[model samples]
Structures are given as structure tokens and as C-alpha cells.
Target: MTAPADVPPEFLDRLRPICRELPESYEEPAWVGVRWRIRKRTFAHVLTVDPDHQMAYARAVATDEPTCVLTFRSPVDELHALVAGGHPFYKPGWGADVLGMVLGDGVDWAEIGELLTESYCLLAPKKLAAQVAGPAGLCC
Candidate 1:
């Protein structure tokens, strides 16, 4: 499928399905990148790579080259584990429960899908989450 002009094709290919499948999920422009929301609350967001921005918060994490980063809400333990896992994942200096991961080559799409599912569960209302979680409490 063709991606939106502003979104990376690879990102759309990998993440769109996961986000779209969840009930009450939608996407919108989030300043420089995009954000996926459930019940009007953002569960995942992405930012365009920008090394030279006036606001330090706007700059991407220190990297050798430009790289888009996908940030998502995560449980604290999971957040730390992702960081401990190595490159491609790190904590952005933002929300206490939010973590950032560089999106590029070698990314583990399956793991990312799991994280997104978890984030959706966290933000989605209990009833909606239960519906998405299916019979075994696994993501749909």
C-alpha cells in the first residue's frame, strides 16, 4: 500500500496494520511526524529525524546520521529492558513511561508489534482493551 506523503513507506508498512486493527484507533499529523491514538489518547508517536533544531527537545537522539524515531508508551520495566537490549532502542527525554526507538534497518518488527499492542492495551478503555485482547488476553 502507498504511504502518505509525509510518512515513511516502511513505517506505514510495518505499523499501520497493528494500529489500524485495534478498535477506536486512528492516525493524525503530530507536528513533524505522526501519532496513533486510541480513544483520543496517543499510544504511539513518531518524529522526523532532526539533528539541528533550536529546541533540544525537538532534536533527535544523538546518532551518526538522520533516523526517524518511534516513541510509544510502555511499562517501566519493559522500557528499561528495551534500552538494555541495545541500539535502535532508547529512552527519549520525555514522558516517564514513554520510550523511543530508532526505526531503521535491523528493527524487530514482531517485537515492535508486541509493544504497540501493549501500549494499546494500556491506553484503551477496559472494555475496548478486553475486546482487542481477545479470548486469551492476547492482542488481536
Candidate 2:
């Protein structure tokens, strides 16, 4: 897939390595920005939300400026705690397991890496998923 012109190259630079490490994962251009997938299932998607066009994300974050956003799947048990904090995180008005995060200053790349790993595990086929280790430190 061609690189998405809307997403900042720097953002792709940070995300590409983490997604690449997963077995069988690949990058593709999404309708909006870009998405990383394990086979056909998307685990992580990044897009820039312009309040003028995307009201849902703009309202969710309550920001007037264009904001870069990353959406991913989170385990149900951890969803509330992550979104409850609010600022950088929010529940998108879609899938039960889907969550959106505002990406900008002070964002944690390490945490993003861990979360993306978990997201990949959740969507990838069982055999392929088993080939890669889960996030560091916490247990299933």
C-alpha cells in the first residue's frame, strides 16, 4: 500500500517498526490515514482528525485544532481504566473494544508499542498470534 499523504511521516516512522516486528503484519492505506493489519483484520489505525470534517473525533477530544489520532483495539477489562483518564484517550463511537488516542506531545512510544502488540494478538489468527510474544510484564 502506498503511504498515506495525510499522515505525518514522523508518525509513520515511529509506528512502522512496532507493526513490522509482528509476524505476517503489513501496512495498508486506510480510507482516512493508514492502518496496520494482521492478515485482513486491522489492529491499529492512525489518522488526522480535522474538526471541519470529522466531528466525532473532534468532539471526543474536544479540540478545535487538527489532531493526529490513533485508534486500536484494547482488551475489554482494560478499556475503562484507559479511557477513564480522558485527556489523550477516548472511546470512539464504534466497536466495543475499539479505543482512540490523541497523539502528540508527551505521548509515550513504549506504551504504544505494548498496546499495538496486544492489539495484534487480539486480531491475528491463533497460530500466527502464538508466534509472537505478548506485551512485556503483565500476564494473561
Candidate 3:
């Protein structure tokens, strides 16, 4: 699938390698940005154009700088702690199981990679998840 026209190439350049590492994950346009999905389930989605999303994330993150929001699945128990720990993340209005994190300067790519891996494992089929899990163990 082609990268969404609205998504910045620089962001995609950094994101592609992480997403592609997951088994059977594919990128495509969804809503106003891009999403990585496994079969029918979307494990990660980006919101780059919507003003409401931007404002909400900026408010949650307490930053006015232009930033892209990446919403991804997290373990139900870890969701609260992640956002509460001042990690530049928050819970999306959509649900409690998913969390939104601001992606911009000073972002930790290694952590992002781990989050993406966990999100993919959560949405991918068992066999596929197993293939990707390997030595990483289940969700990080």
C-alpha cells in the first residue's frame, strides 16, 4: 500500500522500518493520516491533520509545537500508567485499551519500536504474532 499523501515523508521514513518488522503488517491511508493494520484490525493509526486531535494532544502533552499523534494499542493495565507517568501519551476518546502518544522531537524510537511490536502482536493472528514474538517475549 502507498503511504498516505498527507503523512510527512520524514515521519514515514522513520516509521516504515518499525512497522514492516511486524509479521503481515501493512501501511495504508486511513482517516486523515496513515494506519498499520493486521487483517481487519488496526493496531496503530496516525492523526496529523485534524485540528481537534492536534489540540487535544497538545493540551494533554502541554506542548504547542506541531506534532503528529500516533494512537496505538497497549495492554489494558499499562494504559493508565503510561499516560499518567508523563510520557507524552494519553488515552484516546475512542477507548480505554488504546493510547495516543505525541511523536516529535526527543521521542524515544526504541520505545516506539517496542510499542509498535506490542500493538502488532495484539492485533495480528496468533501464528503471525508468534513468528514476530521470538525472543522479545509477548507484549513489552
Best by lDDT: 2
Q: Candidate 1 lDDT, tens digit per residue, 38-139? A: 978999887656554314433436763346778889899888998888777787777888888877778788888888888888889888887776436765
- Count backbone clashes in candidate 1: 0
lDDT by residue for model 3 over 24-97, one digit each (tens)?
78998885688999988998887563344556555755655445778899888888889888667877666668
- lDDT tens readout by residue for model 2, 1-140: 12322777788899999999988999999988899998899999998888877788788778777888999999987878999888788998889999889888898999899888888888988888778865444322
Candidate 2 or 1, higher TM-score: 2
How high is the CA lDDT of each candidate model?
0.76, 0.85, 0.75
Error of 1 at 105 (Å): 1.1
* TM-score per candidate, chains pooled: 0.84, 0.90, 0.81
**Best model per TM-score:** 2
**Clash numbers, per candidate:** 0, 0, 0
- Sort by TM-score, best first: what order? 2, 1, 3
How high a TM-score does candidate 2 get? Answer: 0.90
How good is model 3 by TM-score? 0.81
Error of 1 at 70 (Å): 0.3
